[model samples]
Target: MTRLHTLFLIGMLALLISTPTFALTGRVINQTLNRPEPDIEVSYILHETGDVTVVRDTTDSKGQFILDVPSDPGAEPPPMLFARYNGIDYPGNPAPAGDTVDIPVFETTESDTAISLSSHHILLDAQAGTATYIFIVHNHGDHTYLTGGDHGHGLEIPLPDGVTDFIRAPQGVHLHGTLLVDPRPIIPGNSQTFFTFSIPPSNRIAQRITYPTAGMDLLVQPTDTPVSTTVLRDLGDVTLGTNVFRRFGAEQLAPGTQIDIALSSPETASNLQTPIWIAATSMVVVAILVIYMRTLKTVPNRRTILLEQIADLDERYESGELSEDDYKNRRNALKAEVIDLSDSN
Candidate 1:
């Protein structure tokens, strides 16, 4: 072969060998409505509509889920992905954080990534009497610097006093007691969202109360790195009226998570309503007493006689210093008159 032909053939072979390979890539994440929940399920799904397509997935266990999609070279540009996991529909698997692609794979590493949340601490409001709080440590995908394994997102909350009664938490679910302000985990590069929970009584309002007087400390794990930020909130005042308290913050949660709270005061017990039978009996007793008092036509005569008797006994006891026995006998006679008056009614 000529030297030029040999060189040309070698270059072509190198080009064919270096071409990038494409594969199916995706992940399933499971999650629940509650935090710190355990045993969550992550389901994956996909759907197509006409020429367009969408894909999505979710979990009952602490909101964990995954999405795996295979790319087809036969499809036109911008393939579609869809999913309907546990009744939630995603026209297309929303890209995580900063990237976007309808197809599961185009060109990327780590095809599947799992995401979930962990509950760290809860806060309470002493003055406003509302329990306001935040769930810390929600995990997302790996960033360039903070690899998905590194630093994730965290939430902070300032709880007001007197709102929730008992809270139930399951694994992977963090159940907040009464909440003043419930904030969603601040996804990096996303707009902030909040969940507003008020104490039962609408009139009882809690406003800006000073944040943690001692302040809060953020300690990152794997290393003892401490994050410092002073937490504060406006305290609210109570008005005269009915107050509502929460029973369960998150209805659905993972299993096996512990639920509890440290309180400023024990929750007030609910009062039993007055029964109809008891109310009617009391009303009849009151009516009888009222009628007896009104019908006492000889009240004046009775009052005069009792007064005279009492006066006579007092004079006798003081004058001769009547014997103790005689004085006691006469006093008893006078006391009977008063007792009679009460009994007549």
Candidate 2:
């Protein structure tokens, strides 16, 4: 072959070989504004090895970036690519070359306007001199609400005076005297808090609160389970029931609104079987199973769900429920499943 022709053929072969490496293109935008977000950092994380390959460019003025993810033939499965913005990561769908990926990001803002009480379940243990309060706080707004210090998202709840101990607070919340303060930012979604504390024995228990939003579903346990019997002093807008009193509607609780629940031990109140407590005990199992089922939809889903399950299992094992052998076995099984699923994909 002629020298000129040989060089041209070699150049063409190199171009063909490099084409697949530059297949993925991405764009980042402000979800609420539908505008390009420039100068935001992005990353490509490998699914298998946890190896991260960062791109050279942040989103340009047009909120666009291109990544050259070359497939490793030596790796059992082609490494999946993930696009990360800020701290949240998003998986990339496998697509043909030149396909553009759009990533939407929202700017975090402090706002209490969208805060609402989705559910409030109160359980009073008169025998133990304690009360358990479960509150599901929801943020319906587009921005996040930060808690703690001045100018924070305020959710001030007043406890009955003379409480001895603050037993538990959810991961993000902190106990301050008789009040609960969430130190983490409440993302634009539902976050739950379980507050348990000791209180002085009294015929009546009152809950007072001033929140930024209106409406809440209040559930007070009646003469059922191990908890003591509690009667609503004033029905107000609540609908009475035998085992639990439920109130759900657009009943706006004005600031300093107090809900008084009177406690009385009825003759029929009895301790239920221990098996009935399975609902709470099975949370970890249920969470793992749900994640497994959700991941069955796709390989990427499986990878993410399995990783989450592994983390949850570690936490559960550390809490002393799972033995070392059991934890290692389960973790290994999940890792193998992840590998098999990735290989299949």
Candidate 3:
């Protein structure tokens, strides 16, 4: 080939090599119960340490998704791309038991791996008073840090429908003191954050609170799971009553009156039961002492003679006048005398 032709060929080759290449593209669809869950945010993560380059995506109206990720130029083989749809940690429940996708290992090459996540919902409705109900959100998963800032994991709870004119405590953030939402990032293994707040009384029936929609990318080990904890109340409930600054307690609660009571930890529970137990124990000891004192009157009062006999036995034994066996016999005789004197009562 001529030199000019060769140069033109080289330029064409460089252009082809420099062109941007797409790593992988796909969408995360929630196929649970043959339906799609919108508003479920997706995240792309690095498996180790859950350090992630987050790409937030929302499902279409039909639950379809398409992601365009660029190839990593520095990677030798390029890292794999996984789709974490909604909360399902895997993709395509194709198996009979809903098999999830395996999170791929990091590499220098582009890999098309899809991740799916799932969730279960339960309904809990209860009444609250002026006191805030604190929920300490402990992030047991990876990325163990409180991202909720100063408010902690605050969730803005809207007043129930058709209900208003209620008192609010810590009202600046939202209608409710939202900083106490659960599942706040704790050290995946050893650390956690504490959150507390008071829940105000609301007459509304359709109250809503803004809760956390996503969590940190922490690898949950085989033994890792959510552990429930009992809430320990540091103070008794303050109730409005006729007496000044007085309220009814467990001991004085009236029949059929409703009250809020929190479960105590083992140590606190033991302390609570101690007072009654000690009182009963003292009564038992007193009863035993009284019985022993009553039995004393039935014994004879021969103190004078008993002391004389015991003194004589001790003298003989100490003087080396009594053999081992003889000393024992004399001691027994003296003991019998003392017993007989008591019977004379």
Q: Mind giving the per-residue lDDT tens digits that candidate 1 earns over 224-327?
A: 11112223121222211122112212222233332333332323223212364334322322232222223332111232333444554555577876677766
| Sort order, TM-score high to low | 2, 3, 1
- What TM-score, computed on C-alpha atoms, does each candidate reach? 0.20, 0.49, 0.21
State which candidate has the highest lDDT.
2
Count of clashes, each model: 65, 0, 25
- lDDT, each prediction: 0.31, 0.52, 0.29
For model 2, give the RMSD to the true fold: 11.0
Question: What digit string (tens of lDDT, one per residue) describes model 3 on residues 1-345?
Answer: 999999999999997887353423333433323355444444432111112233445556644444333334342112223333322133221111122332211111111111111110111111111111221222223332333433434322333334333322222233333222322222222211111122222311222223331221111111122212112112222211111111111122122222232212111122322566444323322232223223322111122223334454555577896676766765565455446534432
Model 2 vs. true fold: TM: 0.49
Candidate 2 worst ten-residue window by lDDT: 225-234
The TM-score, computed over Cα atoms with residue i paired to residue i, of candidate 1 is 0.20
Better of 2 and 3 by TM-score: 2
Top candidate by TM-score: 2
**Predicted candidate 2 versus true structure: per-residue lDDT over 64-126, tens digit per residue:** 877666654343223344444544444545344657777656555556677776545555544
